[model samples]
Target: MIVTELRFENYRNLKNNTIVPAENVNVIYGENAQGKTNLIEAIWLFCGGHSFRGSKENEMIAFDNKYFRLGMNFFSGGREQSADIAFGQNRKQIWINGVERSSSSYLTEVFSAVVFSPEHLNLIKRGPNIRRRFIDAAICQHRIRYASLLSKYQQIINQRNALLKDIRKHSELKDTLAIWDDSLITVGAMIMKERYDYLKMLREPAKTYHHGISAEKETLDIEYQSTTKTDENDDFGTLTGKLRAAFDASQREDFYTGYTSVGPHRDDLDFKINGISVRRFGSQGQQRSTVLSLKLSEAELLYQKNEERPVILLDDVLSELDNSRQDFLLNKVEAYQVFVTCCEESNKVQLKNGKVFYIENGVVK
Candidate 1:
């Protein structure tokens, strides 16, 4: 996927602006708080229409401004497409090709963007939720059905929890608990299957990239840490049945805890380097290298599945790497569209064919 044009108005500190980026690599440099990362975020948000920085809608509006708007024209499916977004304090609207659409229709067969930021360097050491989110966000882009199932599963869990809370005061509500359990088990099983399939496809590439970055000294291993053991040869029916049984076994405990106790919501991704848990055993460099490998692996996996290299947004990531590692990263993504944010022109990683833009107080020059 390639973005042919991008423009923003009243977004963050940036004024009405347009960015013309080279298809290969675009390097953006500025001093601290000059809106370098904000520019990167605009591209990511417009491409996928989701916030990678986890900012809310109103927070993205410029100070003293009424609203924010972004326009993105991209090339996908051997043709061009566009998305326009407008957001205010309490409302947001999205349009695809001038046709009003909801944000729910995104990432099905639409645009894909892979991002790497400094905060992700702690993926291995952070709580399990971060790692699970990493897998969910990446997989959801490639398979829209997985996203639907995830949403339904979350809803089922919420309903089940609410029922549990009511059951404490009125024991009569306990009889209908099986209805939610069945739905949760079915959807949760599919979610687990998809996550397992994705990680299974991702493990080899992540290890290869990890070995390249670690100089063959570290081996990356990934696995699913679910609430219950998964069967290898079971079909969907059998898997659902097994999960349902597990839920039934945990029902009393869940009722006591006032929530659904066993499902993918509690699942995690287990990472190890050379048979040792990276969370406790890996050094700082090792953790960063592992996260980098996984992210690059995500880009490669998307390309393999979609037949289009995703637009990569690097948010002030190179500053944390050495010269060799920086060069290696640039070399790895040279063939795809990339946008890198940095603090200085001298600190930029030189590329064979890349455009450089300067930013000052949110204006691109």
Candidate 2:
């Protein structure tokens, strides 16, 4: 998806203004905390997801302002369209082409983007939750229904955990535990299936991108470390049966822990390079390349499924890479519109062709 024009008002530290960017590789440069990433974030919000920086609505409003407003004009579906967002009164509202939408989730189908920042390195350095969230977010972009399924699965897990804790207090309510077990297996199995399939599709592309970035000296491998022990060959029915048995086997442990410990919620992704665990064995450069590969793979999958190139947002990532790696990243994304944030003009000199925006004290010059 190409954004031809983007406008922001009373948003974060940005002055009320708009920018028309080049269709390829727009570089946003400024001093630290001068709203370079803030500009990238304003565009990312249109993707119908929470801020990648994890900011709340009130935090996004400019100082002393009651609300924030953002607008975008873009090219998608063989035509030009527009979308607007306004946040105030403890609520966020969305409108597409002048028609109001009840929720921002509807914009997921209209705009697509893949974002990379220094913090994303946590995908490998952090715990399983980070990797789990990365996979789930990727799946939700194309399979909108998966979002609801995930929500339902979390709710079931929460209820089951609470019931497990209660059963400890009164053993008589133990039999009622079977009710949540049945529902958990039913919903949890589907969650595992979706995660399995999405990882299967993601593995090959990620490896290919990693191979290129690593100069073909390394091999990348991605595997779903399911708590159920299900594999790619397992059918949905088989997944449910295995998950049911797993829950039954883990009952003693679950009861002792006061939580449902065996299901998709406990699953994770394992990344390996050259037969070594990237998390524990890989160098800093290797870790960065692996994350970059996964992100590019995410972008490729979005295009393959949606038939539209997603906007690429790079937040102060180029300065952290070597010259060769930087060139590889820029070349790989040349076919789509990109917005990169950096604190130095030298990073802006890397792109062969692109428009540059300089910002100081929240104003783009």
Candidate 3:
């Protein structure tokens, strides 16, 4: 997918702007706090239906404005499409191809984007929630059904936790607990199976990409750490059995802690190099390379599954890598349309064919 043009109004620092990105590599450069990152954020929001910076729709409006708008034109699978989104304190709407639509439906037809920022290292060093989010976000775009399943699973988990918190006092809540448990097991088991399958598909590509980027000096391994005994080959029945046993074993602890602990919600992804845990032992460079590999792997995975490439968003990450690593990244992304943000003009690396837009204050000059 390629974004041909983007227009933003009262969004972040951009009061009103329109940009036509290069088909191959488009670079936006300026000093810190300029509107470079904001431009990319708008494109990402339109593609994924969420802000990469974790900002809310209302907060994304210009400081004093009460409303914001973002629109983009792109081509996917050889077809042209456009998406427009407007948000305010009390209302929000999305339009695709001149027709009103839900953001979820808009996302399915508009575009897909994969972003890499310096902060992505947190996926490896942080808690399970971050890693889970990484997986879910990628999977949600590729498999729409996964999003519905995840939403259902999260709701069931929340309800079950509430019951657990009160079960001990009521004693009569056991029956209620059973009801949520059944739903949890059903949805949780499916979630776990999908997660395990995604990890399995991600492992080989991530390892291969990491090895190539690292010059084969280090071996990369990805392991899915779940509470259940799930493998790449496990069926739903096996997963259900494992989850059932886990719930039974954790009943006492759950009642005491007022939360259910053993399920996909608590799962994590582990990264290792030469049999050593990267999160605990890898150096900063190693960690960055691991993240780079993981992201590139995601690009390849999306292409493999959908038969089309996803747009690449690089947020102030070029300056974070050495010349060799930067070249590797630049070379690998040549096949897809990329939007990059940099703090200095010098940080804007050379590209074969791309646009270099200068961003200042809140304007693109």
Candidate 4:
């Protein structure tokens, strides 16, 4: 699927405007804080992604403006489609075509986007939560049910944690913890299964891309260690039973810790070159290649699962890569729609037939 058009009003420093992106590749360049990334953010939002900059909805509104709107026209599944989103400090709503949808779940149904930003370089160097978020965000877009189960599991964890804390004052709360445990196991098990399954599918593609980008000098391996025995092919019913047993064993310890300690919340995705971890021992180049491999793997996985290539959002992601690696990425992604952002005009992304846009003080030309 490719974005055919984008329009936004009162968004950041950007003036009210409508844009028609290139069918294949587009490069957006400007000085820092000149709204280059803002353009990419608008497209990413239209593709159903939250701000890679982590800005709040209010921050997206223009100065002195209380509301912002983002709209997009795209071609997906052999037809034209559109998505419109309205944003405010306290409220946000999305509409697919002209009909309003209940939630953002409909966003993924119409379009898919895979994003890469400079911050993702820390995917390996960062803590487990970052990796977990990487998996959650990517998988949620592919499977809406994964998002639902993951959200339910998170709510169950929060409520269960609060109950654990309250147990200090009301000992009777201990009896009801089992209720949350059941829900947690039921939902958390599904989350773990989906994560494990996606990671498994991602492994071969990531390894191959890492091999190509690294010039065949290094081998990439990813292992998903879920809270349960996810490596095994146990059915859902059997997995639920195991979750129950694990939670039952951890009940007393969880009560004392005032948190739900055993679930997907604590899961980790391990990255290795040969047999050593890229996290602690890998060099800077290794880490960069690792993240790149993971990203390309993400795009391929999305295509394999959805049968459509996702739009690639490179939010200043190439600065971290060497010229050779950058060339490798551009070549590999030539068949897909891409948006690349750069701070300098000399940005080396070779998009011969691609449209180049210059942004200055919020204006694009």
Best by TM-score: 2
Q: Which predicted model would earn the best lDDT?
A: 2
Give the residue spans of candidate 3 off by over 4 A.
63-69, 86-93, 99-104, 158-167, 170-183, 347-349
Clashing residue pairs for model 4: none
Model 1 lDDT per residue over 1-365, tens place: 88888899999988688887888888888999999888888888766556777898899999998899999888888988988888986888888888887663563457777888888875787788888888998888778787788888888889989999999999998889888887888888888878878888899999998887766778999867778666544678877887887788888898899987777898887788998888888777677777888887898998998898888888877665666667766666556898888887745556667788899998898
| lDDT agreement of model 3 with the native | 0.82
Clashing pairs in 2: 1-309
* Residue pair clashes in candidate 3: none
- Model 1 regions more than 4 Å off: 15-17, 67-69, 80-110, 158-182, 231-238, 241-245, 248-252, 346-349
Clashes of each: 0, 1, 0, 0
> Looking at candidate 1, what is the lDDT of residue 208?
94
lDDT digits (tens) for residues 1-365 of candidate 2:
88999999999999999899999988888999899999989999998999999999899999899999999999999999999999997999999988999999889879888899889999999999999999998898768799999999999889988988998889999999888888888888888888878888998988889888776878899978888877867888999899988999999999999988878889888899998999999888889889989998999998898899999998977775777777776665668898988887764336787888999999998
Between candidates 1 and 4, which one is better according to lDDT? Answer: 4
Would you estimate the TM-scores of all the predictions? Answer: 0.82, 0.90, 0.85, 0.81
Ordered by TM-score, highest first, the candidates read: 2, 3, 1, 4
How many residue pairs in model 2 have overlapping backbones?
1
The local distance difference test score of each candidate is: 0.81, 0.88, 0.82, 0.82
Error of model 2, residue 95, in angstroms: 3.6
Once superposed on the true structure, which residue ranges of model 4 sit more than 4 Å away at CA? 16-18, 64-71, 83-106, 151-188, 226-260, 347-349
**Candidate 3 lDDT, tens digit per residue, 1-365?**
98998999998998597888889888788898988878878888876457777877888889989899888899887888888888897688888878887655557555888888877889988898999999897787668799999989989988888888878789887877778888888998888877777888888988888877677788999888887666657799988888888898999999999998888888888899988999999988889889878898898899898888889888877765666666666655568888877776644446557788898898997
Lowest lDDT 10-residue stretch of candidate 1: 102-111
